[model samples]
Target chain A: MKGLVRTAVLLGVSTLVALDTYSAEPNARDIMEKNFFVSKVKSLKTDSTMVLINDKGQQRERKNTTLLKLQANGIDSKLLVKFSTPADIKGTGFLQVEHSDGEDDLWIYLPALKKSRRLVANNKKDSFVGTDFSYGDISLPKVDQYQHKRQRNEQIDGQDCYVIESIPINETVKTNSGYSKKITWARTDNFLETKVEYYDVSGRLLKTQRITQHRQVEPQPARWVALHREMTNHQTGHQTVLNFDKIEPGVAAPDEVFTTRYVERE
Target chain B: MRLRAAISFAALMGVSGAGQADDSRVPESPAFEGVQAFLQTRRVSGALRADYFHAAKRPDQGSDLLGVTAQIKTLPELGERIDGKLEARITNPALNRDGASQSRLLEGFVTLHLAQADLRIGKQIVAWGRADGINPTDNLTPRDYTVLLPFEDDQRFGTTAIKLDTYLSPQHTLTVFISPFFKPAMISLPTAGRTLRETTPARTLANSELGLKLDKIGEGLDGSISYFHGFSLLPDLRLLGSNPVEPILESHYDRINVLGADFARNFGRFAVRGEAAYVDTRDTAGDDPGIKNPYLFWIIGIDRTFFEEMNVNVQFFQRRVRRYHAPEGIADLQARAVALLNALIDGQRDRISNGISFRVSNKWFNNTLEAEVFAVLNLTRRDRFIRPLLTYAFTDHWKGTVGAEVYGGAADTQFGSLKPRRGVFAELRYGF
Candidate 1:
């Protein structure tokens, strides 16, 4: 009985030591996942103000508010971006629907074009309006589209984070590839992405977008208030920055808004 | 020259200004100025390369190696509401290589585009219509320079044109533009630049000049179509001058009339498109040249992805040239589609004599790579020839090709002059 007790104690120690230890260094992947899964959000439905400044430091202001909603099912999405800020952009509206099949659709109505163009199977690498941020960076594809791998913890915009990488699977696409691979850094507390690096088809670092500003919500646990994103494309000397203001999430969006007919005719 | 450049510069500035217009892009907020500040920090990030070369045809060809061309373009910029690009190109490859009076190619010109309408001035290549020759067109013939007149095989005429484009609706797009330019020499024949007077029946010869053109284009389900009209000055040489009589000789000049239209449509794996055009050309009463030459061209193709890795694009193109004679000078300009086909296939791999060609890519390597193999066989009994071509894109930017052209016919046959039968070519290119 004494010998058996001693052997049992030795086995327990060995098993405990064999387990791999993980540290609490928040990386990019953590930031990406955290920003993606929000347990709660609020909507403004009222007029919202926004500002744009060019590389030359010239500034332009616009007022626009959107009827926004969110969903997390077979398809996840956000709906209704109505420009209410700048006088000219007062009525511009668009809907973004991201599907699990690895496609994100955008429907935008431009008064000048009279109707909206349905941008389907959009190029991931294409800059959003020539900004540092590519359309792909802002969109979240179906969860299974990427093979995720964890990397070491890293710092993004001075924030401690966890780092993760994702690689694509589909190959039929030849030209206009958005990114070959991506490195994402997420905040340690909430797992929201803070920074990401996009590689070109040639596996070269094409662009990088970093999240700098953050705001905290009073009620949510580990959830953030605001996220400021900035992107830079090395190939083309261009950049884009996004300032998502007072982002409150809470609204029921219509499913029909995601259809092609709505995108084309607005 | 100063006026021309100034006009071009002003038009370029206009287009560039157009790119800056967002139509409805308002900043997201008052403090969002950082976005633009970040983008402006990037400098022009691309390279430019230009080359010029000339080849002599024959001794009597009168300096066949005539012109030069230069072109430059900028790279795509990241993060701007509207990315702008600029291009300037100039060329003069019209050296009368055919030993005839008029050798035309790129009469040479200057053009600039700031991501908007294209503004061009000076001598340049302007193509009208869609037919191979019956109608007027350019850009189809290889850089080899030929007598594809009315179609201007590498031929360039001097002119200034502006092209405007606006997206009317998400499903529809509209473009409209007008242009004016100088005319060429009259002693040159139909393509040699005839004066309006030379085109008239009253004078022994009539020539016309001072031309104007206008067009309207619209995008459709599969593609787009454009309609156009042109009025120009031309020179008449009914007397047919010989040698050079600088300060003397009798020549008439008058206005010429020209009008045409083009259409194209492409859908998925299968596409059918063609062009039909007519030219009511005027010539001397005794001139037996084909007057109402009608050119017709069409292409039909089926594209499919055989498996996950292999892609195939099979197509067939048919072209016909019909000439009209007024039964006056008793001259015969005899040319047939079959004869041309035979001339194109005289001696080559793949087949002996036929107008039909088959193309296939990737039977090996599982298709991670691509290769297009084409063979043209001539079935006509009169003349025979064969052609085979293979091209491949090694990587995203590197591509190479090799092709052979061969033809054969009897001594008195229509394809008698093309004895050397085959031409071999190899080339490699990389994009930045």
Candidate 2:
């Protein structure tokens, strides 16, 4: 009994220290409540083509595309990612991420050989179309899906930031994920999450996601400078870099675009 | 096998022209992974199970045993093609009021895959024939002579066999099998693998033999069909099955020919299935030996999904069976072989058993409350019986079924003894 108490105390103190160290703080939620604005947001759509460079400097390029539409009057958006190029995948719909938590549901669709499938949660760590970027890292995170606790203050690329530790309260929360906990760094000024590291159910580090080149002081008349995300799978040594190409504002698409008819309008 | 062979044939034929239709047509479980990717899961697990059986007649007597099984379902996930189920079962010897409990290592085997073909080594279930009632070609495993009938229970035996299964296409498969003579337990053995003086197991094969089979069929929602022929070693136990030192009589009943076919197709809400098989057994029958019994079986049922949310289902089933005459020479093989069987039967030389069973079930109330009724009627000369049963599935994995059977007919028929067979069974199962 005494040993149990001593162990519990040690765990509690260590957890507090770890949370303080990785907090990305200045507090991501507080920043979320502040700076970031989708004032004139439109349906964001893009064809993110990727090129892989081997150690020997050889390149294998793939035509991967992602589509997202902002929810009118809200910062949330519904997203779908598809890989369609290189002749190998002419019309393969790789994935579709939906937001359906309450009436608000979330989903990801995959079309490889003519059939499409729903990519569900417990899949946060699952590869995205054979890529390293987990489904959760690429898709939008639920507002406070986890209790965000600001741990420490840090600076990345000259931006003031708040490092926060997010822990899922109940097992029922669906992030299409299996993460026990995650440490995220968010810029306090812009409220944009800069970096995140995910841990497995066993509390072992599984992967890392780093967001770069925020629409910071855009020279172009774009609402967001197109956020860049790089996701790496530590176990497989595979990584995928995503670029949001076409960014528009003030266009909250109605239910029409989420339909199968428009998704495959071709 | 038929489906696999068809798949290959279709692939070759289609690629020569266009693309082949695939299993994508069959709604797959979100959990099912494709062949190439499926080969990557390396899973190992252990399980423990207990079975307790109580016979109504034996009030104070019952059978109970606890068993443990360890399975390695995956080989080195590296080769991208190691296949087959390999598991070992160990049951501890225990006291039983009804029967003796014995221990044995159940099964162990490995399967190797090459392209679309599969090769299996070690003891395995060499299941054969599509005939529902009679599977004459399924002989790789030894016959459990004590069962209601030979090969009646799929769990009884796993013989050392080598089989090759090749998929002709996504819809067709073909398999050939051979079981080099493996020893079968001589029931008369005073001890495991032992007799009065010398140990004698009823099995003999001076040479190895091969069997060929071909199947062309399938009806997923409905059923499947096939044609098969195999040389199975039938123990000639005229000697050991008799009194004292029958001196291990062992011989072979070679060159058995079987022509069989079976299928079931669902026309709307009604599902119909049937099997017709003829076995030209190559046993030299003597006067007292039994004849080769061929049979035909047919079943038709209608399952209408009246409600989805409630999962309410109602169905009706009907079955018809026809028995055939045994070969003239069957009555000739070592006389005792026939006498031993005749002693177990109280019927006339010419016998027939025909029956039909029907059941109806309704599932509702959060899938918790369920009601079911079943009835069976025996329709044959010198035989008559009736059985009624009920069942309820209280939960997803727990259910109870109880039934009572009444017999009325002369002692010469299955209705003999008027034993009034009845029992209640409760089972619990959980899946991961």
Candidate 3:
């Protein structure tokens, strides 16, 4: 009886130690999930400016207002974007409803046409409004769509980050996505993504995105927001920078604001 | 007219002054004030456009047209429940006889907003259609066929009317329109030693037009049903007096009723749209040789985007005339020719006519340059019209476009009848 008791105690202690070690270094999937949840807010509104720079270093700018709301069920999000600059594209609006279990819904309104049109949401690899960013790049990615693996721990720009590599888990997603794999560098303390590198299907470097100008909005929850982001295409020598001029977090946005009716309204 | 101009000028000055006051930190000077006032007004915006057209048949068969369009609107804050807009256009053509120089008011309207509805009064353009390029239900608006413009949108002409729009919900809306004035579509046809005159219905309450539309927007699909009771924009040709070589023809408007419905839906990578309209003419018995019979027109279309940016749209359209019969009781050869021409132009001879149209467009260089091809083929008549265009934006406010309109088939067919009008056009525009 003494021998049996001693063996049971030893097994329990070993199991506890192993769990502590495992918890210290969480898996890539858990880290990514944490990153997603930490970045999400109840609702947000922002005035943004997008600058597009070509190989010649010439730049063009576009101004827009964006609104986002997380559904009450917390499984869906609605986003509305209205462009106000460049004269020709003024009064253009886009509305999107992102779902976790099914396909997303997207609609676009052109003031010249004076009508709203529904767009295919599955073709997310297309460039968004002549910008370098694809629709998938602008949207929040589904965590289950990819298989994530921990690459290593590294310091980027004096900040400690956990580098994670994510690859598409299915052929459909792989074909639909412009990138085959993406490596993300997320800050260890706040889970804010600092940098991301995308790889083409040929395993070649395609683009790199860097986030900077972090601002904390809510002190209690320690919410950090990225006020500026820059994406550069390596093959094309084109770059796009997004600057959030104003951001209001936790704002109240009704569902009607995300509907097509509102998009079509001047 | 003087009162209207004064009011518009005052509104523009008020907006400009307010805008300047907001930027009071800048040092004040006469030159600076003048520049600032011109730049600050939100009420006025205008565009200057110049176009040149050349025909393939004659090297000298070309015209240069310069035009300016101005739009003015009341300030939003000052017009919480009352809003107004005025649009005016002036054009000068170098070699066109239709009009050497003309000035016209494109749109002028005042709107009163209510809790659940709004009312608009005066001359306005009320566009009603879901399909691209062609709309079977857009009968309220009149178009100018003689306009020397490359874009179809430029052909629209406003009509004096009163419109009431009621919003039932975010998904549904009801609209009613009343037009006390009658405007007929103008088509420029070669007289060929004949005299032609157009007569419109008298502007009276008895001849007023009425239209109603119920629209369902959003909810995964968009659709609308509409009804219009008014005079047909197309005119009917009547022989007033005739001789062996010189004939006199008068074009007169006919009363008609139309019921229309349109729907659009998206499925995965494809979008589908359908529109149908039933038109009833004044000839109920279908035996009158001078009036048209009832007809049904429909269009179905599909659109899709591929290769990231290329968009393609294809549509099939058909028009079926009810109780159709060829014209008879014509004794003179010239009269028979006139009757046949009238029958074809008025859609009175064909029992069934169909056509297919497609538009393919793509943009490059960050949307600075666009290339498009639009083609329509009349299956029954074996006639076709093709337009290929390229547009480039030199700057944010400056654009240039070049295109050609080509027609083919027998001269009696719809597109072929315009074969002599086939031409290539180039345009440059600046917007401010």
Candidate 4:
């Protein structure tokens, strides 16, 4: 009788322990989903300056205006980037429509050509206007497309963070993307990504991105915006610094702003 | 020259006067400060360029050209519908021993914006067609081939017209253009062997040109269909009188109607584009040797990028003449020679002519240095033209470029005939 009672007690404790472990540590996918929604907004407009530094430390600066808006009926978003400086590239524009279900659509307008041309959507690993940021880096990744795992809990810059390892779920995404895997450090308090390390196809560190500045934009949903970012490529010994001069959240952007006609307009 | 100088000075003074007027009229309130700042941001910007060319065989055709251009634009206040733009350019050729310098207004237009439509009226460049390098539907604006510039964009000349664009939806638009002035393309003639004269149509409403286009923009594809009722920019050559050594010809424009369509789409890492046009030269019977026969022109191209930076484009083009025939009637030996020359040069009587064009470009050093190569091969004529160029941005507003144009093939072919004109050129430009 005593052996039977001990077996019941042991089973009860084991069940409770399993439930506790599951509740205390959330899975990687859920954590990433939380991080993705932490700062999502209806619309945003930003004036930014991009500084590119070569291996020799020579620098070039480019200014741009960016607008982003979420679709009303779907999880997709639209983006427009217009270059405003460096006279040779002035009046250049890029428009993108990021779909939730599949690949994104992109178009580029060149002032010299005086026309807007549709660009292949699969070139996500290409540089964005000579900057270190690739097209994929500038766009938000679809959370479900990546397989994620919680690596550990650590502290970076004195803030507690959840270190997560993310790998592409399929060969298609892995082959097209510049990085084989990415390890992200997200703050526990706000779920803001503070740092990320990118690995190449050979599993070598290719780049490191750090967010140095953040500002709270909304109070109700607790939205935070990164005001400054720096990306350094390990293999090329090149760096790109992005400084946001102005950021406006919840701005009203009409659908026309995302159209190719608007991109072609002078 | 004096009148143009006066007009330029007056425009400068007008800008200063407008600035002063805005300063006095704007109030000190914070709300008005935004308006004042926006108005002050509207200013004239321009560029100054110097170009030099050297020909290996023809020193007389080489030239040193200097030019300056200025442009100004202003956006209307909120709730207002009127906006305006003004652009002007002046150029001087130092070595050509032709005429004096020239100045002209490039574009001066006023736009009226409505709820779903906009109308613009003045001298403007209406760029049509979607194909790169070669445009079969780009007939609204006339080009000046006599210009020493190598870029086709620089050779375009605007015409006085009224244009209207109506937004049918977010992805569709309808555009209409009406131009009262008929400006024919100006091609340089050989000064030694030919005496050339031109007869242009009289300025009248009957000579006006009309064009319409329907454009569609979508995620999967983008394209346009257009129709133009206008005169041919290239004139038809007619023999007036001739000697055994020299011939005198009258070049005159002819009425034409064109229907064109173009489309572009992207598939993963590749992009495809196609353009086609059918031209009706009014004389459909192919009986007149002086006038070109009706023809169908088409181009299909693809683009791809490799190695992260290199972009390559290839295109196949063809032209098919309807009711084709060879020239037979000739009254004089010189006239017969001229007719044969025209037939050979125009390639309009050929049953079917095909060609291929390819271009590759790459950039380095944060896009400061760019190199490009472009080639066009005439398969039917066994001729080819190649151009290679390198450009460097020295500063934020300064640029330098060096390039060479090369031609090769049979002596009677188009590119082969211009073999003597092949040369190297350099240019420097500063913008503000």
Candidate 5:
């Protein structure tokens, strides 16, 4: 009778622990898919300021306006960015068109040159116009490009969060992104990424990005936008902070706004 | 002499009209709302610049200038659909020293936005083609080669025209342009003792320039087909008397028609671009030694990025003369030299001449510093030219640029003939 009771207790405890584990850990791909859709609105327009601060406490500021619209099939997007301030770079613009199957198309217009030039999109690791945020950081990579694994659950700034570790799947992704691994901290309820840490090819910490001031821009479908983001490079002791002055989600825009000709307009 | 006067006019009018075309903006601070409000109606901005150049071969052949430029662009107010822009510049120790200070109008244009079309009328620049550094189909706007600017595009000046762009579809556009006046390129040659006179075509309806282009954008490929009918921007030299010591030459414009097509497509991380143009000139028989023969020019290029911020672009170009004739058979050495110079300058020295262009650029220090090198080599004549540039941004409003231009090969070759002009230059600019 004693032996049977002990065996029953062990079996019950094991089953409970297994059930708890199964429910506690979610699929990495599912989390990423939700995170990707969190900010994917029909269209968006925003005016923002980017501040670059160096190690010596010197700061340089740049103002820009961005317009983005979802393309056909609602998976890909096209984006246009125009510089508004910093007299030297004023009137410069960038146009990007995302593709579902292949590489994206990117073009830049320099007011000084009075011409637009198409550029290769492989420079994902390059600095984004002197900002600490790299081109890869500004662009959203496909969810399948990296292999993701669940880490642990923790509370960050009083909000429950889940940590996820992602590693590039191939040499191309690794080289293009210039990152060996990335660790992301996302909110549990909303699937909004709150923070991310990047590791260089040598597995050293390169940069850290912190996102805050999340606001729900759309109601029916539930969309949220981050009002501020700070990206810091650990090795260089440089940081870039982006603050959105005005953000309009689900706005309607004409398709012509994404064209190179329109982006080059004064 | 007429040649000396023509040279002076070209130096004064051509070189003075060269610079950048941009609507600079006043840097805004969020705290200064009052200033920002006033700037919205009429955006006024300007730049102060100082330039210095020195030639290695000839110490006295370079230029030094201090200049200030102002540009004003009016933003639409009260829901108006029209806007205007004007740019002007004043430089000291003008290329023509007849005046202590000289001023030139760079661009003054007004644009009207219609439902499906935009009409622009005034002095404006219309740059065409997808090629880098060299563009064969870009013949509408004339450039001053004598301008002592580091970038070749800076030598371009605005021309008066009426341009209309009609949007046929979201991905297609049709552009039409008409110009009442003719502008010829100012080319500097080694005319030590020659008496040359320039004669521009009369401003008549027949001599007007017209262009039409249909452009397709977006999706996988971007392409365009264009046609131009105008007096050639390049001049043909007519020898009045073939005097070996002091020949009297007359520069005259010829009527020509150009049909051009260009396309660009991206494959993975690499982009491929191709442009071709067939020029039909008056010298159809290819018998006139002083006139240029009909020919075809094409360029194929590929660009890709490696390691992050480094970019490499390589292009191969060819010029094929339809009816070929060699200028070596000319009896007079001076006439032969003149014909040969034209052939070399036009890249039609042979039935088919091939060339290659390479450009590499990289940025470092978070884009604070940038370095670029550009080179072009003629496979047939073995002539080459290389330009290396470095730029540093001191602040958001200040920039410094330093560069060198080098030419190589025999003197009779195209780039080789300009070896004497090879020099290093520097510019300091402050924009506000």
Candidate 6:
């Protein structure tokens, strides 16, 4: 009986030691997975403004309303964006529905033509409505598509963060993203991403993204949302600043708003 | 007296409904609540435009003119399931008219939203088909070809009709349309020593136009199948009589049927769209030289983006006339005139006609500037057309556009006949 008790105590001690080791420093993949899904709320509605500034101090402003909803699977999502200001592009809207099979569907409506057209869904590296943010930059990257490694911890804006380096797993992912590598800075407490640096094929810095402001949207189990973001092209000296005038998380959004018919309406 | 009574009744109902508001809401007088509802549920928007066009060569064929236009649109919501739109336009130096003013209602309609369907009535514009500019299934509305607009779609006008769209499933819809008025396409026909007269079809129950369509809009594909039974928007030329010098031609509408299908699909980075329509005209046997013959028209296009920002679209179109007979060798002068007119209007100069269109567009300067070049080549008839346009946004509310249209080929070809109408144009618009 004494031997049996001694064995159980040893086993308990080893298990606690193992758990402590894991809690001390989580794996990079787990951290990245949390960072990618940090904003995947049940539903989100926001009125956003995007300002583009050139090297010569010229600026342009665009206003839009964005609606986002997570599908039942919790991985796929639907996004709708409608432009309201900037006369030349007023009444233009885009609808994107993500599928589990990686075949997303996109549709664009042009008020001048009074028609909605289906668009090919593979232009991930292209600009998002001519903004400095590429389509790939704004979308959440799949965790399994990259090789992640936990780098040395760092301090950003006087807050502790986990620095992670991610490299594309294959040539297709690399080509589609137009990025060879990405480095992310996520807060240690919430796993909310605060900064990212994109590298081109030749390992040159292409763009830098920074989240300047964020807010806790839910209280029971904390959920955070980025209120202000800025993307700057290091190669072109151009920058785009995005601000959310109003953001409502966990809001109720009807499924009808994601349809092409809704996008075609004035 | 009836209209005034109806207005008063509506106002009374509005005030009565205002009294039933939620108690938690801010308190206000009933009349004030009614006025607030009216103002809060309505949206108003408009644009002012200044345009100029210059014909450098063959000025007699075109014109040099300057014009200004004001477009105003309003949307008013009456209830949870009811809304209406009223769009008005006023222009100086009206289209095809010099030193004239014109005012018209571009679109005015009321829509009723039901559980599974939507019903719209009054004048409205409905665009059909999945193809780019060359749509074989877009025949429900007529166009003004003489409008001095840089974009081809700018010439479209609303048609008075009743339309119903019923949702059959989450991704499928069925549409039905009916119109009692027959509006014809306005084309400038050359009259060199010829007297022409036009007559519209009588507005009768039997003469009403009808259209039906079934559309699927999701699950990786967008497509539709449609059928239309209506009078042809383009009038047919009939030779009434001929004197020694002038030939008298009467233009009349012909009943016709159209069966169409269109689809759009994405394959990797390329989007493919295609449309086909079979038009069955009154000249089924191809025996009548004064009426257009039955024909099949199809178009297939593919678009892709290169270099992240430059988009290129390529399309191939073909038209095939059934039981076609050459109109070149008609012995009688009146018969020849009628045959030529029909052939010209239907683009049936060749039994099998084919063409290609290519467009390249790009944006720069943070999307403040856009440029596009569009070209069409008629391979069978050797006619060609090209348009180049550049648009720049000066500010949030202002924009400027400059473009030029040029046509080339022998006079007998479709686009070639309009060579003299080639010109350069510019426009500035401000929106509020």
What do the candidate models score in CA lDDT, each in turn?
0.40, 0.43, 0.76, 0.76, 0.78, 0.81
* DockQ per candidate, 2 decimals: 0.04, 0.01, 0.27, 0.32, 0.43, 0.34
Docking class of 6: acceptable
Candidate 1: tens digits of C-alpha lDDT, residues B1-432: 334433443453344343244222423344534543332233211111111112122222222132223333332342332233333334333322322332233333344433323343434334443221222322211123232211112233334444343443433334444444334332222223222133322311121122233332212222334444433222222323334422112233323233334443334322232343232333324122212222233434444434222334444444443342322223322222222222222121111222444455443221113455544333343444444445443322233444554556664332333434334433232222
Question: Using lDDT as the measure, which candidate wins?
Answer: 6
lDDT at A49, model 3: 91
lDDT of 1 by residue, A1-266 (tens): 99999999988887766542333333334444555664224332334443334444433444444554445552355555655333223235665655544444455555323334333333444443323544555555543456567787777667777777877756523233456787777676666667778787679987777776665543544335345666666665445556666455444444443432233221
What are the per-residue Cα lDDT tens digits for candidate 4 across B1-432? 434433443453344343233321233477655643454465334566655454422334443323333333332333377776666667664323343566767677888877778888988878877677888888888877666554556677678999998889878989999998988877654446777788988889999999999999776788999999999988777778866777788788888899999988887778888899999997699767677789999999998887667889999999898887655456656666655556654666357889999999998765768899999998888789998989876555566677888999876666776777677766666554
In candidate 4 chain B, what residue range of length 10 has the lowest lDDT sum?
Answer: B18-27
Global Cα RMSD, each model = 15.6, 22.3, 7.8, 7.7, 6.0, 10.1
Interface RMSD of 2: 20.4
TM-score of each: 0.39, 0.42, 0.84, 0.86, 0.89, 0.88
Model 4 alpha-carbon drift over 4 Å, by segment:
A1-24, A218-223, B1-40, B56-60, B63-80, B95-100, B243-245, B327-332, B340-349
The runs of at least 3 residues in candidate 5 whose Cα sits more than 4 Å from the true structure, single-residue gaps closed, are A1-25, B1-41, B56-79, B93-100, B242-245
Q: Which residue pairs does candidate 6 place in steric collision?
A: none
Better of 3 and 4 by DockQ: 4
Ranked by DockQ, top first: 5, 6, 4, 3, 1, 2
In every candidate, how many clashes are there? 105, 68, 0, 0, 0, 0
Tens digits of per-residue lDDT, candidate 6, A64-149, equal: 88899888988878898998765556679999888867678888999778788998777778788878898877777688888999
Better of 2 and 4 by lDDT: 4
Interface RMSD of each candidate, angstroms, one decimal: 15.7, 20.4, 5.4, 7.3, 4.6, 8.1
| 1 against 3, candidate with superior lDDT | 3
After superposition, candidate 2 runs with Cα above 4 Å error: A1-266, B1-42, B45-47, B56-78, B92-101, B128-156, B182-211, B217-255, B283-353, B357-378, B381-432
The true-versus-predicted C-alpha distance at residue A125 of model 3, in Å, is: 2.6
Worst 10 residues of 2 chain B by lDDT: B65-74
Best by DockQ: 5
